[model samples]
Target: MSRVLIIESSARQQDSVSRQLTQRFISQWKAAHPADTITVRDLAVNPVPHLDANLLGGWMKPQEQRNTQELEALARSNQLTDEVLAADVLVLAAPMYNFAIPSTLKAWLDHVLRAGVTFKYTETGPQGLLIGKRAIVLTARGGIYAGSASDHQEPYLRQVMGFIGIHDVTFIHAEGLNMGRDFHDKGLNQAIARLAEVA
Candidate 1:
């Protein structure tokens, strides 16, 4: 059976547009693929630690040379990576914080995008190791940013996902979420419609 890994990064537990979209996507996906296994990792509730010196030491140092703290740090990071490696599909739900993804989501990315594990150095250039996977990103924004230079979320995520060999990526954005009622409703409905078509 196919495995779907969902990473949720919205901080709000209630009335979160990203969360709502994710719930809809999950429901539709389950209806369409009853045999697929879905796993959700809520970064806001149980946030992963940011990349730090201990994680760096854990990655760089040999097992015999690494301290207990470093080994523990590495173990946690490896678990995240292993989950991604086992998944056939990835779903990321992110709400616009500043101009980019949430810090918690970034931390999870740092854990999974490992060298020689998810990617490796090649004779010509760097190469991604993970292949045959697809990603769908559900984003909620306060204002319209899609196709604009100020839209940092989509481009950065595209680059990062591409770096890790996830090229079949689709982004569904619910923009103008904090705008007037008309704009909010329109944006959310449009996003949900698109998600229905895709999922």
Candidate 2:
């Protein structure tokens, strides 16, 4: 059976549009693929630690020379990396914050996107290690910013996913959530319809 890893990064547990989209995606996905296993990692609930000196040292230092703090940091990174490595599909719920993705989500990405693990240097350029994996990004934005220069979320996410060999990625954006009731409803409905088609 396929394994699906979902990353939830919305700060608000209640009244979260990104969470709503994820719920719908989960329901639809389960209906379509009943045997597939799904795992959800809620960053807001238990946020991963941001990259620090210990983490960097843990990654760079030799195992025998590593200290306790570094070892613990490495262990945590290993767990997060292993989860992503084992998953067949990756789903990310990224609620836009100041025109970018949540810091928690970014921290999780930092843990998994490791050199010589998720990617490696090649003769031509850097190459991604994780292959045959797909990703789906569900984003909620305050203003309309899709395909525009101000839409930093999509482009950055696209590049990051591609860096890890997840080239087959689809983004469903729910924009204008804070721009009046009409825009909110329209954007949400459009995203839902797109998700329905995708899921």
lDDT of 1 by residue, 66-166 (tens): 99989999999999999999999999999988989999999999999999999998999888787899999999999999999998999999999999899
lDDT of 1 at 156: 98
Ten contiguous residues with the weakest lDDT in model 2: 122-131
Tens digit of per-residue lDDT, candidate 2, span 88-108: 999999999999999999999
lDDT score, candidate 2: 0.96
| Residue ranges of candidate 1 with Cα displaced over 4 Å | none
In Å, residue 57's CA in model 2 sits off its true spot by 1.0
Off by over 4 Å in 2: none
Clashes of 1: 0
lDDT of each: 0.95, 0.96
How big is the positional error of residue 189 in model 2, measured in Å on the Cα after superposition? 0.5
